[model samples]
Target chain A: MSYSILVVDDSPVIRKMMKRSLSLSKLELGTVYEACNGQEALVVLRREWIDVVLADIHMPVMGGTELIEAMSKDPELSKIPVVVVSAERNAQAIAHLKTLGICAHLTKPFTPEQVLHAVDDVLEQVAQRSVA
Target chain B: MSQVLLAGPLGEVTKSVLSEAAFLFCDELSEGAAPLEARLVEATITFEGATPGRITLRLPWHVACEAAANLLGAEPGDDDVEANAHAAVGELLNMISGSALERWFGSGSQWSLGLPSVSEREGRLPSSAPRGELVALAIDDARIELEASLGSVT
Candidate 1:
């Protein structure tokens, strides 16, 4: 089965890389959506049926932290899982994201396999929850 | 205002991140001319914390092209395609700098980055620019140099 995903990041290159990496996964690439920042991701979320959101921590306009906060407060958006992929591995940053209930965190310079594994793990958890 | 030293973990963070990114993206990296002729793709962000500063990525034309090509999933042809190439380089710089800043400052620090500026040719450095450390890394077949200089404001 295929699921839709929303990728939010300010960098076009990273976005492209994420898309490519996702394409390499068992998941279908056509269902993936792209957003340059949190604000844009929110707009896309309202319009699309996204099962998960993959975000970067720092972005112009609206960042990952703000995005998570906004999503967490909304009854409708809160159900969708958010997985953060960033180069920031600071303890405080990790703790803050955890407070927001982020599903998983992937550090930057990660191999394509790492990205695939994270996506798979998140999807598996979501499936188990739905079954429960 | 107290003097903000560009020392400690921040400096080390900058060096390691730049080196890793360069190695991952560039074909080869090497040391070039002094006063370092660089092509800069800079993005500025304002932080609410005690320590705040701008992050910039300076890459040579070759390294920039290689990065762009890698991101685009294409092989770079010639210098004429640099405009398109730098677009990719600019985005790469933005991503690298954004992640680096989040590490130095807390993720919740709430910083906003500006659009990156890509400089193809080296420009004159300001006389008042602080002299900081520089490191180079080689990727694939290109060389990339990163320098962390202190600006007027911290």
Candidate 2:
């Protein structure tokens, strides 16, 4: 079945590139949504029925950390998985992200295949969680 | 460390990112090669922490367009590529800065990377700028410059 997804980042170029890369994924993809930052992403998550979220940290207004934190606080939002795509390389920062409940992390300069793999991996975990 | 010493890591990170992210390969320009004399797009990013510094990238407009197109897997003439050439350069700098910082300090260290800013620049590209140039590259039909100016790190 096809799945809807949301992409959150402050850079339009990155947002555009991620959208293009998502299309390259062999998954049965549905409508892909976009947001400029966490504040905007929250609004979309509240209104849309997105199956997964691919987000970037280090954004203005709000960042991926706060977005994930907000989602974790909400019972319904927390169920949907999040995959972080970012340029962050700090060990502590990445570890901090793990504590926030992100399903997967993909560093910058990733290939479209890499993005697909991340999406697939997270989706698989969600499927397993539902099965058990 | 001085700019001359730090440029090595900066160049290494730049080549790696450009090759992977933009599907472009590059090499360090030799000492004798003619300097890059052309209109260019300059992108800069800052790292704040114990050692605050800035990284800048400068490349020709065509190269920027090509990079944007390649990153999106689109043609250079596409509307999206034309509109985002500056932004493409900026993001490229951002990626380069993140890795460069990691290499300079330990990956486990703490540092905050700022958003990249892009602008237009024109001049002859030397091996190093007054602030500091990590390296110069020959990519396709253009020359690209990577620079970093940082605080004292002994």
Candidate 3:
């Protein structure tokens, strides 16, 4: 099965890399979208059927935490799983993001296998949710 | 801070980050490495928390291009390579700074990172810049430099 994905980060390089990384991990991807920051992400979310969102925490206009919070407030958008792929290392901030309903946290310098595993887990959960 | 104290962690972290993020095998250069020259990309990230400081990363253009190419699964000569390299350096600096902070301050400590900015470096850092020990690495026949300083400089 193929899944539509949204990659949100201020860096154009990271956004491009996530798309390539997904393909490298052999994940079945549909339409892949890109957003520069949380504000742009919200605009994409309003228009597209994004299955999952991969985001970075720090951005210029809006950060990932604010993006996730905005998603959670919307009934439709909240169902899409968010995977934070960041260089963030603070335990407290990470814990807080989890409480905000982030599905997975992939640290920077992650291997392909790590990305594959995290995405797989979130996809499985998303699939199970759809069945229920 | 002491060079020994800072360089050790910075080198280890830089090697690990480049390996994992860009799939490049890198070695920390202890000596005999040439100084940075033309076609270089440098990024600086500021930290705020228990201890506030700044971390700067410098990479030869070739290394930067390879990183961007590898991450994009594209050829070195691709059209976007240069633009992508600029962005990749910023992200790479972000990772390096985060790793260094976690190592020195422990994972539980709270710290926020500012957005990374790119700077032009012809050969060396400015003299006015507080010289925290520099960590140099050899990656794919190119060099990468990382410097850390305690407290804010500006």
Candidate 4:
């Protein structure tokens, strides 16, 4: 199934990288949206049908953690799986993000294979949740 | 002391990150060989928590183009290469700062990263930084400099 995804980062270059990585890996993708920060990501989520979110933690206006927190509080947005694509190295912070119910964490400098695998993993969880 | 501890991981992290993200191969430059020119762009990301400091990355114009091209999956000569280089440098520094902080300060530490900034004007290291190191890396036959210093600079 094709998935509609949102990539959120302050850097346009990194956002473009995510698109290239997904296309190069041949992952099934529907309409892919881009946002510069979490606040913009929220607007996209409201307007589009997104299945997954890829985000960076350091950003202007809003950050990944704050975005996740906002998503968690919203019923519809909460259902959409978030896969963090970040440069976060703090162990506690990563663990904290996990507590918020992120599907996966892919560190920066990640490969296309990693992205495919992470997204696939999130999809599997969605499938299982539906089955349950 | 801090310099000896940090220089290795900073170089190793830079090599790994650039290799994967930008498809750039990096080698450490010998000290005192030649200074990196000021024409390069510099990106800085600061972190605050248990340890407060900043990581500054300098990218040669050509290497920035290569990184932007690789990230965007475009040819190095593409017209958009120059436009994307600034963001590419910032993102690279963001990754380096996060990875380096985790290794240096431990994983459980709480650190908040600042929004990355890119510019031609370089930042001076803080005087409060008791010890720090500057790492020079060669990528695509061009030199990029990285300076990791402790304490915050205003």
TM-score of each: 0.75, 0.94, 0.91, 0.90
- Residue pairs with colliding backbones in model 3 are none
Name model 1 segments beyond 4 Å from true: A28-30, B1-48, B78-84, B87-131, B136-143, B150-154
Q: Judge the docking of candidate 2 as incorrect, acceptable, medium or high.
A: medium
> Which parts of model 2 are misplaced by more than 4 Å?
B127-129, B152-154
lDDT: the better of candidates 2 and 4 = 2
Report the C-alpha displacement of residue A57, candidate 2, in angstroms: 0.8
Give a tens-digit lDDT track for model 3, residues B35-114: 54556788888889877888888887788889888877789999999778878888888888889889988999888989
lDDT of 2 by residue, B22-61 (tens): 9888976766887777878988888888878888888888
Tens digits of per-residue lDDT, candidate 1, B21-71, equal: 433533223335234344544333333334544545555566666666656
Q: Work out the iRMS of candidate 4.
A: 1.1
Query: Which model scores highest in TM-score?
Result: 2
Candidate 4, which segments miss by more than 4 Å at Cα?
A25-27, B36-38, B121-132
Per-residue accuracy of model 4 over B1-154 as CA lDDT, tens digit each:
2556888888998898889778899976655655444457778878888768878887877778888898888999988889988888888888888888878877877888788889864423222243357777777557777888876556
Model 3 misplaced stretches (Cα beyond 4 Å): A24-28, B1-4, B30-36, B125-130
Every model's DockQ: 0.28, 0.79, 0.80, 0.83
* All candidates: CA RMSD (Å): 4.7, 2.2, 2.3, 3.1
Q: What ordering of candidates by DockQ runs from best to worst? A: 4, 3, 2, 1
Predicted structure 1: lDDT: 0.65
